[model samples]
Target: MSSRQRLFTLMYRVGFAPWDGHPLPQALRDLVEGSAALPAGTALDLGCGTGDSSIYLAKHGWTVTGVDFVAKPLDRARAKAATARVVVEFERADVTRLSTEAVGSNFDLIVDSGCLHGMSAEDRDAYVREVAAVAAPQARLLIVAFIPGSSFGVPGIEPDEVKQRFARDWTLLSSGDETAMNHNGKNPARQYLFQRAV
Candidate 1:
C-alpha cells in the first residue's frame, strides 16, 4: 500500500475520522437531484467517504466511481453500495495522482467532498491536473470544502487558493456558503461550481 494509504488506514483503525459517515451532506443530496441533466457518462466522487455520494449517483442512473486513498473507507464504501442496491466501483486511490489507467478518463462530472482543502499546495495542483486529465471538456465539477477561517491554522484552504489553482483550465460558475453538516460545532464551508474550459 502507498504511504498515504497507510496513514489513512491508521486513522480509520484508530477511530479518528474527522468527518461524518452517516448522512449525505445537503450539498451532495441537492446535487443528486439534478442527475437527469448531467451527462449519463461517468461521474467520479473524490474522497468518497463510505460511498454515499457514489451510491446516490449510481441510483440516479449514472456510472459512478468512488476514489479514496484509504482502504478502510473504500471497503465500507463497497459494502454500503451493496446495501444500497447500487453499483459503485470503489477504488483505493490518491486523488492527487488519479490516472486514466486506474479509473479511466473523460469523466462527465466530478465531486469533491471536503478533500481539496487539506491537501498540500503541490498535491492540490496535482489534483487539479488529474481532474483535468479525467474530465471531458466542459465537464462540471463541484467542490465542497472547509473554508478558511472556519478553524485556525493548518489543513484549511481559502477560496482564492482553489480558484487560482483551477483558473487555468476551469471557469468558475458559482460559489456560496454551504450548509453541509460540520463535525465540530459548525465548521463553516463553501461550495464552488465550475466547468472545464474548452
Candidate 2:
C-alpha cells in the first residue's frame, strides 16, 4: 500500500486524524463566511479530513471537491457529506501528484487545512507547483496550520516561504495569526489565507 494509504489506515485504527476533528474549526468557517464578494464557483478542499469544510462550503452553494491522501478519511468525509445532505466529491489522491484533470479542471477557490505542514520539503515544492497550475486566476486559497512557536511536529512555514512558493502565480491578499484554543483551552494552532493573482 502507498504511504498515504498506510497513514489513513493507521489513523482509522487509532480512531483519530487531524482532518477528523469534531465541530470543525471556527477560524475556517469564519474565514469563508466573512469573505464578502465570494464568487459562487468550484472550490477545492485539499487534505479535507472528515469533510467538515467541504460539506460546509457545498451548503453555502459552492461546488466542492475534497481531496485526501488517505482512503479511510475520504470514506469518512463522504459519509459526513451524505449525512449532511451536501454533495461533495471526495477523492483519495496524493496532493503532491494531484492533477487538474482529477479535480475537473481549475478551481476558483482552494482551501488547505493542515495538509501542507505534513509534507517534506521536496513534496511541498511539488505541491506548490501543482496548486499554482490548478488554481484559476484570482482564485482564493485559504490555508490553516501550525505556525512558528507552536509545538506541532511540522516546522512552521514563514510568510516569506509562502510568498516564495506562490507569489509567482499568487498574490498575498491578507494574512494573520490566530490562537485556536479548543474546548479545553489547550492545543493552540495558527492559520493563514491568500488569493491567487489574476
Candidate 3:
C-alpha cells in the first residue's frame, strides 16, 4: 500500500477522520436536486468516506459507486448501504491513480467532496486525466474543495489551478459558497460546477 493510503487508513482506524460523519452539505443537495446537469444516471463519489454521499445518490435513483482506499471505511460504507437498502458499489481505490479497471469505463456524474484538494499538483493532474478518461459525454463534475487558506497542513487547492487543469476539456458552469467543514472550522468551501466538453 502507498504511504498516502496508509495514512488515510490510520486516520480512519484511530478516529481522526472526522469528515466521515458529515451529512451532505445543503448547498450540494440543492445543486443536485435543482440542477439539470445531474439526472438519474451512474454516479461516482470519490473519497466516499462511509458511503453517505453514495447512499444519497443511490436512494435518488442513481446507480452509484463509492471509492476509497481504506478497507475499514469501505466496510462501513458497505454496511451503511446495506442498512439503507441502497445498492452502492463500494471499492477500494486510490484517487491519484484511478482507472477504468478500478472504477469502470464511463460515469455520467462524478462528485468529489473533499478528495481533489487533498491531492498534490501531480496527483491532481492525474486525477483530471482519469476524470477525462472515464466521464461520459456531457457528464458533470461537481467539486467541493477548500480554497487556499490559513489552515496549515490542510489541502488548500486554488480555484485557478482547477480552472487551468480542466480548461481544455471542461467548461466551468459556476462557483459559489458552501458550509461544509473540513478539519478546520466552516472550511471556506467553494463548490464548482463543470461540464465535460461535447
Candidate 4:
C-alpha cells in the first residue's frame, strides 16, 4: 500500500489520532487575522490530517478545500466540520500526485501542516511544483513541520531543507522555530511559514 494508505490504516486501527488538538495554532491564527481584512478567495489545506487547520480557516471566513489521502481522517474531518457548522470541501487524494483538475481550481492561500516532511525528496519536489501550479501569484503558504532536533520517527525536516525546496518559487514570509504541545502533552514540534512569490 502507499504511504497515504498506510497512514489511513494506522488511523483506522487506532481509536484516536495523536495530532487532533483543540484550538488552532496561535501563530497561524495571528497571521491569518493580522495579514488583511479581506476574506481569502480560495484556500487549500494539503495533507490536512483530521482537518483542524481546514476547519479553522473556514471558521475564519476562508472557503477551504481540504485534501488528504486517508479515509478515516477525512471522515473525522467531515464530522468535525459538521459539528462546527462550517462548510468545507474535503477530498481523498494523494498530495504527491495532486492536480488542479482534482482540486477544482487554483487558490490564493495554501496551508500544509507537517505534510511535506513525510515525503521522499523526489516526492517533495513534485509536491511543491503541484502546489505552485494551484496557487495564485501572491498566494500565502503556511507550513508547519518537525525540525531536525526533534525525535526519530517524527519526520524531522531541517530548516535548510525547507529553504532549498521552496525558495525557487516562494519567498520566505515569516519563519521561526516554535513548539506545540501535542495531545500527549510531552512532545513538541517546530513550524515554518512562507509565501508564493509575486
| Most accurate candidate by lDDT | 3
Q: For residues 76-102, could you state the per-residue lDDT of candidate 3 as single tens digits?
A: 999989999999999888776678447
lDDT of 2 by residue, 5-63 (tens): 57667867798554455555556677567666575689998888778889989998999
- Per-residue lDDT of model 1, residues 36-123, tens digit only: 3664668999989787778888988899999988778888888888888888889878888788439867888899877887777778
Residue lDDT tens for model 4, 13-44: 68645556644655677667866543567899
In terms of lDDT, the poorest run of 10 residues in model 1 is 31-40
Looking at model 4, the pairs that clash are: none
Model 1 TM:
0.88
lDDT of 1: 0.80
Which pairs clash inside model 2? 19-49
lDDT of each: 0.80, 0.74, 0.81, 0.77
The CA lDDT at 83 in model 1 is 85
The deviation in Å at residue 115 for candidate 3 is: 0.2
Candidate 4 off by > 4 Å: 35-38, 179-188
What is the Cα-based lDDT of residue 136 in candidate 3? 90
lDDT of 4: 0.77
